[model samples]
Target: MTNWDDFRLVLALARTGAIRQAGAALGVNHATVSRRLADLTRRMGGAVFERISGRYQVTAVGAPVLEAAIRMEAACLEGERRLRAVSPDMAGPVTVSLPDAIARVVLLEELTAFAQANPDISLTLKCSYAYADLDRSDADIVIRGASAPDEHLVGRRLFPYALAHYCARDYFDQVALPDRRWLVRRTPAQWIERSPCPEAPVGYVIDDIDMLHEAAARGQGMIRGACYIAESDERLIRIPGSKVEPWEDLWVLTHPDLRDAPRIKAVMGLVTEALMRSRALIERGETDRCRG
Candidate 1:
């Protein structure tokens, strides 16, 4: 009988083609990878790798073994997801990944409420710009802005997201836009060309939306951000004549294999309900200060 673990190591080595790289990817040492490969080759009675141009290449005999190993890995992962989905108890960790801005301003309270309601379930709120890999169990759920979702994953479209220009109450002045300093995310060019205050001078280039909002509130300069956050903030005032900057559709995504998990379902239900209830605020930027 062939050991699946040995085959997994072989597959990784074949995929990476370097002992150091494969070891790093598999969280093992280079010596371990070499030792394991030697043992695997001896057990199989054939060389699985061949040196080609000073790089390791899978041998003819190893190709089929690698393919089988990949299939086995997929099957095992799917089985785990399915088993987790069918768990009768609602006790486990559910990691939810989303943009830092949304997590801080919009989802924070709702997430807190959900956590309080479900003490048995542990929740990890990952705030990041990088997309989490649902297929590999990087996260159990994800809230993201996307125009199109992967066909393999199951997702629910939440609502449309939009951005607008805003400034602190004291920062607003009826002057040439070029004179005012701009608080931007990446660079001023992308926002300025499309913004109402196109020529606003660049001052601060911040990556984090929450920090940008704070700076704008302190009268640093005008800032651009999601309408839901800017409108709700009392310290910031929306710029007059600013147009809605529609980005992408917000979505709640999960792996197809774990879509039926009770914990995932409960979290998804609460999150969906919360977002649905705040649709007007999130989509239309409905706020008492819209006129201000």
Candidate 2:
């Protein structure tokens, strides 16, 4: 009989197409992944994956196995969800996934208070740009910025998310309009064309939002960022002519199957209430100090 554990290896390897990546996803070492793949291949009496150039490609023999693994994985996730749905205990670990920026700027204080108030419920935060697979139980709760959430997820649209152009206060005062540039997350041309300063040069292209903000704060260039984050920073100030751009709605979501669990419900309620209380700041980027 094929071990379900081996099938998990197969799924990971097939999805990632590299031993190292698969191991990283599975939280195991590359050597362990290799050894397990070798053992599984021996049992199957043939190779499952063949390296073509640099990547592992699924062999003809492995295609059906991959399909079966996918089905089994779905069934396992469904069973887990069903079990959680009926769980009565409110005291246990609940993981919330969200972007690092949101955790830092908006929700951290509220989440900290939640942790303090509920010592019985252990809170785990997975902060990343990558969306967690709630259906797969990657997270019990998810806070995300999205145009619209998936049909499988249940959550509230907290507020409209917005971004605005900002630069270091000193930079804004000292830099000549012709000399200023943009620190951006995308290609220079893309940002420059859309920006108010179309003729401005690109100072830096950074993938991380926090790093981009830092660059802007250091007077490297102006940056377009979520209004709440940029406005909260004392080092930064809004560009003179730039306007806030409405992007998407901020959502707090969870899989329907797990939504009814006592801990999940409690966390969701608290988080939703907290976010709603800050809806004006999230939507318009106006804090008490900023308004003053």
Candidate 3:
């Protein structure tokens, strides 16, 4: 019988098509992967993969084995998720995945408080723009900005993600009308319809929101960003005639299987409440100074 670990090696190799990449995925070195493949070949009495143009391709004989491996892997992951779902104890790790901007500007303080309050539960945050796979257990909780979340997940839509144009106070005052520019993440066509200064030429095309915010703060040019982020920055001020545009809704999500777990429930509650508390600011950038 093939060891499950060896099967995993095969699966990894099949997925990545390179010994080095497969090793990296399995937390082993390329030599270990190669040796394991060699050993598997000896035991199976045939080659599982063929090298074709510098990439590993599964052989016809290996196809059935790969299919079985995939089934086994899925069953293992499901079993693990089921076990976690029924765990009554609140004293294990819970991972939350969210975008870096939201993690930094919005939920940092609240999440910190949650950590202090729940010392027994280890909290891990995966901050990125990429979505983590809930079905694969990549994250226990996810806070995302989307028009509609995956229907399989269980969670609440917190509020509309609002955005508006802003720039450094000094830049707003000092830059002449024609000289002023817009700092954007993409082509102006994407946001020009919503911009107060549609005529302003694009000054800088920055893809990272954090970098764009910094540039705007440094008086480089105007930027359109999340209200919750830019409105809180004292260095930046909204453009005089800018209107808040509603984009996708912000959602807090978790897999249905894990939703009932004690620790998952607790964390989800905390996050939902924290986000809801800021609904006004999130949905419309409402503030005393910004009130129409």
Candidate 4:
């Protein structure tokens, strides 16, 4: 039988190069370190380490085993940390990943309220366009846009992800859109045709939603973006009757293991309620609905 404890002795000895230091680190006597190494070498039919200059020098064959031992220790430590993070108790860390645009415009104030409500649970909001791996626990909860949600996770589907054409409040008044350049994410043929200024030349092709929103707010040019974001910004106004692009279903997802956890459930409930309350703004740029 191969005991990982023996391999750990090998790693500790390799790192420190002295039996006394290895024994102190492992909370064992120096003789126990030497005995364990000798036993491991005998079982493997090779000298795991050689004593030279009163220090343990790893044999050529022992280096690979030591490396494996080090990797195993790191993996175990990470596993323990993850277990602590997902503890059954209500108090612990919870990370939610979502698109930057949504996080900034839709979830900013709602999330602040959630944090205030659950002071025991330390919450972290990670913003990214890329989907986080729920199985690996890249994020405890993730909000994403997807046509087909993963079957493994469980959560609520809020609404359809919608986008429409928009521009600064006084952009057209300052410059005729046909004469100015178009601000767009990508040059999609269909989108170009649907834009308010289809004949307008390209001004800036910004793929990042934040930058695109900024440019449009600054009266750079017309942009097509998420209705929730565009509607929330007072500086931006929707292009009248512009084609609305329905992208995908917006969902809040969590791993099955955490589906029933108290803190995760609490956060998910808040998000679902918030989205439900503002579904019109997110699904349609109904400026009147949100405006007081």
Candidate 5:
């Protein structure tokens, strides 16, 4: 009988190149990962990996087995998700991934209240602008602002949010607005069509949102951001009558396994409640910021 569960241990060690990295990702102690790796080596008859100069490398014999090990890894994840889906009442930990802006502006402040009410539930928040892997169970839930994601996800609309340009009041007051000294994204020419000046930004273009946002925040230069974020932060003030694009939906998504879990529902409801409370600022940005 083959223990494919042991193969997952092999794959994790193989990809991570060291026992420590694999342990961190799998949330186990280094000693436990080491023990499992040793246990797995014996059953496989020949050594699967060799440590050379502080790096783990797969042997030629082990290389061919990697493809099959990966398939077992996928099956193990699917099985875990299925068990979690079936066990609706169990709760211990749930992980959520979202952008730093949203997490800081909203979730961080209110999580304490939820924690007090549900003492048994522990929440882990991962802050990143990148899309986390739901298939790998990177997070049990995620908040995203965009169109839809892959067909496998179970997602729901929280609300539609608007985008707008903002700058520190003092910056605009001192330097003057739209004088070609500001930071700009090379969006479609249609985006440049409605600037306060007949001549739009001629230089100093930055494409990354974080750089553009930091420039605007420090009053170095101006850039656009989601209204709910820019308006909530007292550090930034919206530039009224600026161009407004159409609103996009903010989503709460989870693997289908968690689609009906009570604790997941409670946390998501808290987030939706927060969004509703922010509705006034969201709408104000849409009306006050659109130029044409």
Candidate 6:
């Protein structure tokens, strides 16, 4: 009888392409990966890996074992998702991931209300720019900016926004609109071209737009501010005569596997409803952030 442990070891080693790398990926020491390999070989009467210059490579004999292992992992993950969806009680951790900006303002507040409403369901969160792996259980839900969604999951529209140029009043008066001190997003900075002098065409490049907005508000530089932000901050004023544009779409996404589960359904419905409360304004970026 083959166990999941045996299958996992073989697959991890093969996928990593080296025992040491596999060990690192699995959070185990190289010796443990090596010992497991020897144990499995003795039990199955097969050499699963060939050592070449201290690196272990999967052998032809091991390929089938690795294939089986991958299938097993998929089955197990799907089974877990199913169990979560169908649990009789709507109580357990429902992890959500998002970018820090959304996490701080909308998702966090909505999640707080959800936790209050569904007292039994706990909300866990992660904030990052990197996408969470839904298939691997990194998060049960995600809210982020997207042009489109993955075919494997279901996504609901959260909002649309207009992006406009804004700067702190003091910075605008001192730095000039096209000066190097003007805060700009990475792509636009490169597109606009760099100039060394203050009078020369230049912009401050920042990867995080949310942070860029905050910096601009603090008089550090100028940047693209979400319309929701501009409407509220008197200190931050939009650049005169500069055309702004619609930003990317925002989405709340989850695996279809949990759609039927009561807890997941409850939370998903709540979030969708809360975001939609500002539907008209969010669609056009015509309302203030607080109102939305």
Score every model by TM-score.
Answer: 0.80, 0.88, 0.88, 0.69, 0.70, 0.79
Candidate 2 vs candidate 6: the lDDT winner is 2
To one decimal, what is the Cα RMSD in angstroms of model 3 from the true structure? 2.5
Residue 157: error of model 3 in Å? 2.1
**Per-residue lDDT tens digits of candidate 3, residues 1-292?**
4589977988999999999999999999999999999988888889999999999999986888899999999898888888878878887889999988788877899999989988989999999878889989999999999987789999888778899988998886688999998888988456775678878888879998888988998999999988888887888898888889898898899998898899999999988887888788888987656521
Per-model lDDT: 0.82, 0.85, 0.88, 0.81, 0.72, 0.71
> Alpha carbon lDDT of residue 230, candidate 3?
86
lDDT of 6 by residue, 1-292 (tens): 3677788788778777787888888889989988998988887677888877776777787777878888889999999988888777788879878776555644577778778887788887788868988898888988767787787888687666566666676664676546536666664454233222224343456777577888878888656567655545667766554455677787888898876777777777876786677555445555443311
Model 3 residue pairs with clashes: none
On lDDT, the leading prediction is 3
lDDT of 4 by residue, 192-266 (tens): 766766687778689898889889999888887888888888888787668777778899988776777788888
Q: Is candidate 1 or candidate 3 better by TM-score?
A: 3
What is the Cα-based TM-score of model 1?
A: 0.80
By lDDT, rank the candidates, best first.
3, 2, 1, 4, 5, 6
lDDT tens string, model 1, 1-292?
A: 3676777787788888899999998889999999988887887789989888877898987888888888888888878777777777788888999888778767789899889988999999989978898877888999988888887889699889888888887666643455688888885357677776776678868988788988988888888778888888898877877887777898999998888888998888888887888787778777655455
Q: Candidate 6: what lDDT?
A: 0.71
What residue runs in model 2 are displaced by over 4 Å at the alpha carbon?
Answer: 19-47, 189-191, 290-292
Model 3, stretches more than 4 Å misplaced?
Answer: 41-47, 51-53, 187-189, 290-292
Error of 3 at 256 (Å): 1.9
Greater TM-score among 1 and 4 belongs to 1
Task: Note the residue pairs that clash in candidate 6.
Answer: 183-222
Segments of candidate 6 deviating more than 4 angstroms: 14-21, 38-59, 176-179, 182-205, 228-235, 279-283, 288-292
Position 167, candidate 5: lDDT = 75
